[model samples]
Target: MRFCELTEQEFRDFSSTHELHSFFQTPEMAKSKQEDGCNCYYVGVKKDNKILCATLLIEYKGRLFKTFSSPRGYLIDFRNKELLNFFTNGLKKFISKKGGTILNIEPKILYKERDMNGDIVDGGFDNSDIYNNLIDLGYKHNGFYLELDLKKQVRWAYILDLKNKTEEQVFNEFKPNTRNIIRKAIKYGIYVRELSLDELDIFKQLVDSSGELKNFKSSPLKYYQKMYRTFKPLDQIKFMVAELDLNEYSLCLNKELEEYNQKISKLGSKSDSKKKEYQTQIDVLTQRLEDLSVKRKGGDKVILAGGMFILYGKEIAYIFSGTSTKFRNFQAQYLVQWEMIKHGIYNGYNTYDFYGISGDFSKDNKRHGLYEFKKSFGGNVIEYIGDFDLIISPLKYFLKKLISRFGGK
Candidate 1:
């Protein structure tokens, strides 16, 4: 087998059929990285002119030398020990030849099979051998962390399996409260529409507002524009925002209120519980109608929430998302999620990924709401093997580490 540089088409042809390929490992993502001043290259191992394994290396400038990362790592079978060794050696050589100090990789391999609550399944399939293989090959283990590191990959993820399931089945699997929220959004006449490229600023604003509320900084608008320029034409990215047409919703509420009044007037049965339930609903609707009148004075339409979806391989990932705090009662974010989940089911994808959750599952965890929200959709938690750093030059790598320790660029 020979390790060589691959053309864009060569890489695409091989990755299109590879079992481990994800959106991150694509040329489109490489182009997006290029927009950020990162150099991108594709390298792979081939035999008999057939490509076997590949990676997209993203090169970033380091303090003393160039550093690199292979996002989602190589497209190779981690279970194949021989192949893993070959790919690792080739990557190490490739980076060293480029005058790099350290190489970072986080493979798309699961470390252990886990259940819904982030617990290891009983005697479930595991990838401990691959972990050991990486260490034996001189790749320093980053260790399995149970909290968000900010600088490293959030190793844990949540994925809902959409295989062999109908859209109704998927919807029914959501928790009762989650289902209620979606229904509430529907009742509020919230609907999702795809955002055009020019409208990304609106998405940017919402996400930025949410970030500020949480004491975090959001990506600039151009970051999303660059992503659009790279992935939009390929139909691999989707940005959807939930909207409410107040005038139309007002009509719907008026009709519903009339029906409820008619039912109350024609009440013949003495079911006090049912009567109270209907009356309570009527009162709630009345209050909402009053609120709508005031809101409509400002605008007939309003955007409540939005999200970005990355469609690739057999999964649809709900990656970046945001919502307006003023419309929290509408819960339009849930509407966005439910609609996207149905989209995945309709498209015959294998999984719907609710990306990036803290590993701390405690109730007191500040981000516990994130975990709980994803959990309500009913899916297994995924734990990847984590990252590995291959030091190309020990001395240079040591200096770089020391510089980073002291907050030096």
Candidate 2:
């Protein structure tokens, strides 16, 4: 029932085996954040020489006060009320001693049971007790949010369970349209490959284009490069891109066009109805050929879509993704995701997380398109408990909020 600082190895050993472990709690991630100018601390609660709870606290120094955040952390069994209370009280005191004015946590526990469409499941497993415990322990609950705003971590995500399942089993779970789109990408000769470090520029460009199209700002190239360098060596990260092999696709289209032409020629001697049918087929094939030719004339290969994924514990998280507007119909994004899912299955991961989505499932919500796309993959929508702030210095916390509200300098 006491809390103390833990060495990196001690923290990693506990976190790696914890059910709620995430890559954000890893030493490498902490090191990367440290390099980005945040101070990282690993603390654990223990008794009888066994750890019960742990977290990676990131110290952010503001101009006036310091704040701490445990990104998707506070690795503890939330159901244990006593343990939760002890950790909260101990953590507040510890952070206060270090001059921290605020402690923010976004635990990776589910808030409630949610169906695939982001609707709550009635009479399902509820974590209200756990939520109440945190609030009762003096932690201020941040309101449940649906939009992708300034929260340290996303509130909603889509996760596909891959444990004890075959590739066909998982593929069968996808919606019919989703399956068709993946097949279409393959038929169109969309090639997916793992990108090397030197090729991250391709991913950066894809992400930048996506941000521009979505009207959101993207991280600079250096951020992704650092992440790759930090986690790639441990075989914990994968950067994948889908490309259209224009020449090969063009050849396939040309071959199909020739076969259709041959059929049309043979149908000339048959009934007019048969001839008309073959002519219609020819027209479609001919137009597709023309389109392929135009595309091939530009380049042999064109990047269509790319995504970055992180493999930690039992989950492979699809952290970031982007697609090319020019080849939107080609459905390269579907192929990219299929490749990652297959990779996860091959690697024996238990889950494939389509990481973040807007909690607002209403059609009018601007980001609802994201939720729909992830839903098509047949994953359940998950809502986390969201962020909680444990104020260490009420004066500083109040002043900061006041300043933020009035846009103070």
Candidate 3:
């Protein structure tokens, strides 16, 4: 096998058809990263002029030495130990020749096949061999992390498989409460629409607030702008916002209240259980109407939730999103998800990736809410093979880590 740098077209052609293809591994993403002041290049290992594996390498400068990262790296067969070793050796030499000291990698390979509840299937497919192969190739494992770590690529994800399933089938598989929330969002005039370029600031505001609450860094407006400029035209990225119009919502709510009252005042055969159900909904709707009145005093329309998505190849990735706390009870976020899920299903995509969640399944975990939100859409948890660092230049790698307080990975 021969390892060499590949042209953008060459990389794109091979990556688009790879079994492990993802948006992150695309030339478009590489160009987007370059726009963000990062250096990127395409590299591949070839046999008899046939591309066996390839990667889009992203380079970041540190205080001391430059660090190279292969975000969802090496579109290669992990089972091929020979190919992995050859690629690692060639990559290490190639990067070490430059000022690079560390080569960071986070493969998208699944670590274990886990159920919806996050428990490993007793005899499910395991990739410990792949992890071991990587470790054996002189890459240092970052260990299994349970809590949310936004600094690195996601080591865990939630994916809804839409293949060979009708839209109704997929919708019915969602948790009952989840479906109810989605329906409630729609009934309340919460609608999802793609955001225009000028509308990113509105999404940025929500991201800032959500980041603060979750204790993670949020992308700046420029980052979104650059990404939009680079990927939007290629039909690879989408920004969606959920909106609420108080006037229409109020009309709908009033009609719903009248219907409930009519049912409660039926002349005969009223069960206590049915009455209690009607009363519960009436009380909730009344409070929402009151809140709507207050919000209407401020404005007729409001953005309740915003999200950024990566639409590439066979998948639609819900990459980043935020929601307005004031409309938390309205469950606008649920509608935002349903919007994209339906899009993915109708567009012939095979997967809807609800990206990033805490690996810790414990209810007491602070990040458990993220897991629950993703889980409610009826998808299994994916614990990915986590981050690994290949020390290209040991001395500079340690020096850079020391200066950054070990944040280089």
**Which candidate wins on TM-score?**
2
RMSD of 2: 2.0
Task: State the C-alpha lDDT per candidate.
Answer: 0.87, 0.88, 0.88
lDDT of 1 by residue, 76-133 (tens): 8776778878887888888888888888998988889999888889999899998988
Residue pairs in candidate 3 whose N, alpha carbon or C atoms collide under 3 angstroms: none
| Residue 96 alpha-carbon offset, candidate 2, angstroms | 1.0
Top-down TM-score ranking? 2, 1, 3
Query: In model 1, which regions exceed 4 Å deviation?
Result: 149-151, 259-283
Whole-model alpha-carbon lDDT for candidate 2:
0.88
How far does residue 310 in candidate 1 sit from its true spot (Å)?
0.5
Off by over 4 Å in 2: 269-284
Clashes of 3: 0
Query: Pairing residues by index, what is the TM-score of model 2?
Result: 0.94
Score residue 44 of candidate 2 by CA lDDT: 86
List the candidate numbers ranked by lDDT, top first: 2, 3, 1
TM-score of each: 0.94, 0.94, 0.93
